[model samples]
Target: MARRYDPDRRTRIIDAALRVIVADGIAGLSHRSVAAEADVPLGSTTYHFGSLDELLTAALRRSNENFAQALRDSEVCAGDADGGEGASSGARLADELTRVLGEWFAGERGAIELEYELYLAALRRPALRPVAAEWTTSAVELLSTRTDPATARALVALMDGVCLQVLLTGSAFDAEYTREMLTRVVDGCA
Candidate 1:
């Protein structure tokens, strides 16, 4: 019989792999574990992904897709706060931007933890480098729409740092507190 592609099975395995990665981190992922978690035959793991590195690459790509979509959704929801035509004036946009940034930092930490695992994996595998680089560039471009390139990059770094702080400290990194600091850095460039 000719080989057939089973998209659903592949997706199921990938989803299970993500859960495993989230719970145990990347180093703990294995085809056997993923198969058991996916409730598929061990052979099914090899059938879908030729090797462990390939499976991890797919999982990281999936993480990239999921995180990008989450940010897009957050942007849409936050945009609704912009009153109407003249709704978001100068200071308003800045405030709304900070609020949006806070919401993202609060809500997206889990995804970042997954990303942290993916990044560590990427360090060992060159094949995954493109995915990591593309994710970073795409994220920067998304931020650039709201601020200049330099400020956007800075904001990305700040968000990453603040999210890490919150994750490590188990406390909220209030955007309001960072607003003046970020605004000063952003406005300083002009």
Candidate 2:
């Protein structure tokens, strides 16, 4: 008799790969490790992903999709804010961005680490570069809804720097400081 195929197996493998990457870093990823992590047979890993690079790319894509969805759900965009009669749209945009960053720093440190790992991996893997690029594009597009392209790019860079600093120092992320910095960026754009 033929073996049954699990429809969700591919997603499970991708999610397991992310867990492995978060726990052991990108250097530690392997078909066997992912299979063990997913509790699937090794053949499943190979069958779903022809190569480790393919697997890593899929994992990064999945991570990016999840992160983007979280950002969307957080309503970080200007449209979601209740801009009162007197509230400056720019200020509201900055506040929303600061809230998003604070939530990300407070809750998604592991995912952020995985993002950085994938970013570094992309530096070496040409195919993975597009994944990183797409992530950046998505962020910039989100920001561009409230600001110009230049300011959007600058805000994205600032957010990346702040995230890295918070991650590196192992210090508590200060939302007020982030808000102040982002407000300055928004003001400069005006």
Candidate 3:
């Protein structure tokens, strides 16, 4: 006979795993600790996830979903700006990118740190790199439609640099500063 499973309990375990990762880093993740944090029996963890890798995979998927949603939302805002409905005309597109980058950098350091852990894992675990690479590709493709491909790549790089700067220094780079830099870059390319 098959064992019974509690879907809600399973979700709680995964969420707890994420919290543990955020609080203690992925290196510290373990069934006993996660079970303690989730307030579930340790057996429930083994029953729900069978293995640590399985749990991490699920967590990574959840993280990717959140990133995907953010990218889509950013793209929608960019679309509105493209259609001239947002406040800044064509400039609105760049401004939206700046805002998205700022919010992602300043507000979501846990996610960023989680992402760095994922990156280190990807280096050692080949299966994980594509998930992140695909996310980067989608974001770049969205930006490239408004700006040239090369410039779009540069824009993404600048955003990443600004994010790292913020994460390291606790400084908020002004969104307009990026907007102004992109304006000059895009204008010069025209």
Question: What are the lDDT scores of the predictions, listed in order?
Answer: 0.72, 0.84, 0.72
Candidate 1 vs candidate 2: which has greater lDDT? 2
Cα misplacement distance, residue 161 of candidate 1 (Å): 1.5
Stretches of candidate 3 exceeding 4 Å from the true structure: 1-5, 48-50, 75-90, 105-108, 144-151, 184-190
User: Candidate 2 — which residues are off by over 4 angstroms?
Assistant: 78-81
Can you write out model 1's per-residue Cα lDDT over 16-57, one digit (the tens) per residue?
899898888877799999999999888998988999888988
TM-score of each: 0.76, 0.90, 0.73
Q: What does candidate 2's lDDT look like per residue over 60-110, in tens digits?
A: 888788667766776566373564457676667777778777777777688
| Per-residue lDDT over 1-190 for candidate 3, one digit per residue giving the tens place of the 0 to 100 score | 9966666998899899989999998788999989999999999999888888778777776776765577677653245433546455336666667766667766667887786576557677666677667657776787777766776677667666666666678676677778776655545544
Q: For model 2, state the Cα shift of residue 107 in Å.
A: 1.5
Give, for candidate 3, the lowest lDDT window spanning 10 residues: 75-84
The parts of candidate 1 lying over 4 Å away from their true place are 1-5, 75-94, 104-111
Q: Which structure is stronger by TM-score: 1 or 3? A: 1
**What lDDT does candidate 3 reach at residue 165?**
68
**TM-score, predicted candidate 2 vs. hidden true structure:** 0.90
